[model samples]
Target: MTDKPLGRSAVYTVLTTGYTTSTGPGVAATVSYVSDRDRHVIVDPGMVAHRDRILGPLAELGLGPDDITDVVLSHHHPDNTMNVGLFPEAWVHDHKAEYRNDQWTDRDAEGHQLTESLRLIRTPGHSPEDITLLAGTADGVVAFAGDLWWRPDGPAEDPVAPDRDDLRTSRLRVVAAADVIVPGHGGAFPAGEGVPL
Candidate 1:
């Protein structure tokens, strides 16, 4: 798994699993970002190998269970939300229409924060929770697409107009205008396929 920080925001994402695995070609990550002063956020904290063997990376990051600022889950997949409870102080954020949002408040009791991160892209072919996150960062505007669009080896794999036809519409209404794309599992990509965003 790869671990690195994005820019200078203290927002760190460590690859917990990868498509490189012999079992499959899907990548998973444990996403953490600092929301405010001394407040850190975590997302999709999972195990790298045996599912039972979790809770090590958090310590490696010098973070304790109660140090997390929030837990922003992209969807309901266990690979992304399994170790959520390990951080007792985190306020969990996710789509309410699709996933249970109240669980975080009850679990943490410090209140929870919600975001449009799951922008209702409606990319159903991937999954009901296959959504994305649109937020402004120090770098610039971006869309954190969970699995809406992916990079193909060539343009053949590139998402064409209305590429999300598999789930519902013959095409996506509009992808959020942004500078970059922080996909859920894959590495970030130039937004608009490298247009002047």
Candidate 2:
């Protein structure tokens, strides 16, 4: 629902859908976009229900579905990969273990280097197929940590994350390397000293 600049890349988040638990209605998932002049990548494009939410933003940037060079899915979760059909022209990629259908053209074991400055790291914890995109920017390294840990009000353990050990390892790695982090759900935040969240 908002867009902002992160180092050399312009990043944005689009709310996809909502669900109701016993408590009340809550957000289901969010899709994030990161682009530069040459490449436009959609990370976890969310469910089909919010397809327009994805399209509208791209249109604003003077890009169509065909303009997206890469459609990167962090994992195989439906809330993340359900809209893969929308970007047929782009090279769809995910972890090798998570590729469900023939739609994915490339799969990486360690990680894939999308650009000289952007690299995807396999940080499996939230899901066996999870990956994180690290972009070397003018400011510092920016990490697109997908479902590794949900943003909480402060530095607290993610109660809902399935694998605590993997999550901790991934989080510590990101925190050490990244100056800015665009999480799978929440707004971008600064990491390292002074900023604790």
Candidate 3:
């Protein structure tokens, strides 16, 4: 599958760069905000040191919780889904279904287009249900890869992945497709070269 350039590009903002401790219990999920036409999406609104870490940046963008139209989870880990309740009005998207209020619409995330320039693709590895959000922005395609990489350095390997082979294959696919990668628990980085294969 290829990502074709779109006439109207999406805009993305890194709301918070998250972190994880190697030996201790501290962890946070990198959160991102994406906008395309009428859609306002929050990607991985997970654990953070403080709620302001999320809300403040959103406010700076002239948006409030209520303005969010959708929320996407890469997978169902607590670290990647802790603060979803903050967006009470947005539809929640995951690998298997879309949830909004009482409705749970079952649909495959593979090639699921959220907007003209925003879509989801299954990249299961870090978790069996892992999916990546690919946004066609002015800067090129940006992949919000949930724990497909914990960071740009790759961590070289994922200790908790259910399937390492699938993870590697997905990594290659993403590196080939994306110009930039916003990892699950770290800041964004350019794809290729240093990326772990």
Candidate 4:
């Protein structure tokens, strides 16, 4: 519903229809955009249901579908990857462990540099293929955490993650590596400042 700036990139949280509560929607997804010197990169295109909402923000930023050079999936969840088809020309990257599709290539274990300042880290936790995109900007290290942590007010634990241990480990790694964290479902927050355990 709101787009916030995280370093050089912008974080857009899209509310999807699923379980709704008085507090908020039970499920929400995050889509982020990082502008490199040459082209723009989209992280987690979000669900098909929220395609228009996603594209509108991009348009406001003067970036069309064709301007996006890459689409990175943090994981293979429907909410995270459903809109991938919208960008046919962009290179899609995912963990080879989960997606074996020939069209999707594997992200390096060490990490892949999408731009001079943006890097992709394989931080599997919420899913076997979960990854966190780290970008060095004027602000600091901004981490786009895909389901690594759910809500900003909630605990670091992700209720949906099958492996709690893995989630915990990944959460710590993200916190240690990032100054600002763009969570999968909420607004971006400072790392290790007011985050719950």
Top candidate by lDDT:
3
- lDDT tens string, model 3, 1-197? 48533534899999999998441289999999999989999999999999999999999999999999999999999899999999999999999999999999999999889887998889988999999999999878999998999987877779888889999989988888889999999999999698986
- Candidate 1 scores a C-alpha RMSD against the true structure in Å of 8.2
Cα displacement (angstroms), candidate 3, residue 132, comes to: 0.4
- TM-score of every prediction relative to native: 0.56, 0.76, 0.96, 0.80
Q: Cα deviation of 24 in candidate 1 (Å)?
A: 2.8
Error of 2 at 43 (Å): 0.7
lDDT tens readout by residue for model 2, 1-197: 11112335444333332221211134344566666557677787765445687788678778888887877787777766777777767777677633323653455735567665666777777777788777767666777776664442323455555777877777777777777776665556787765332
Cα misplacement distance, residue 130 of candidate 4 (Å)? 0.8
Question: How far does residue 137 in candidate 1 sit from its true spot (Å)?
Answer: 1.5
Deviation from native of the Cα of residue 131 in model 2, angstroms: 0.4
lDDT of residue 61 for candidate 3? 97
User: Which residue pairs in candidate 3 collide?
Assistant: none
Say which candidate scores most in TM-score.
3
Ordered list by lDDT, greatest first: 3, 4, 2, 1
Look at candidate 1 and tell me the lDDT of residue 152: 16
- Misplaced by over 4 Å in model 3 are 3-8
Indicate the residue-level lDDT of 69 in model 4: 80
Model 1 lDDT per residue over 1-197, tens place = 10111222333443342222211344454343434345565555643454333345566767666777666665666655667777666656655432233552323211122332212233333445444444445665455444444321112233322333453331132233446555444455665553211
Candidate 1 residue-wise lDDT at 121:
33
Cα lDDT listed for each candidate: 0.43, 0.63, 0.90, 0.66
Q: Where in model 1 is the C-alpha error above 4 Å? A: 1-27, 30-34, 37-39, 50-62, 97-125, 149-163, 166-175, 194-197
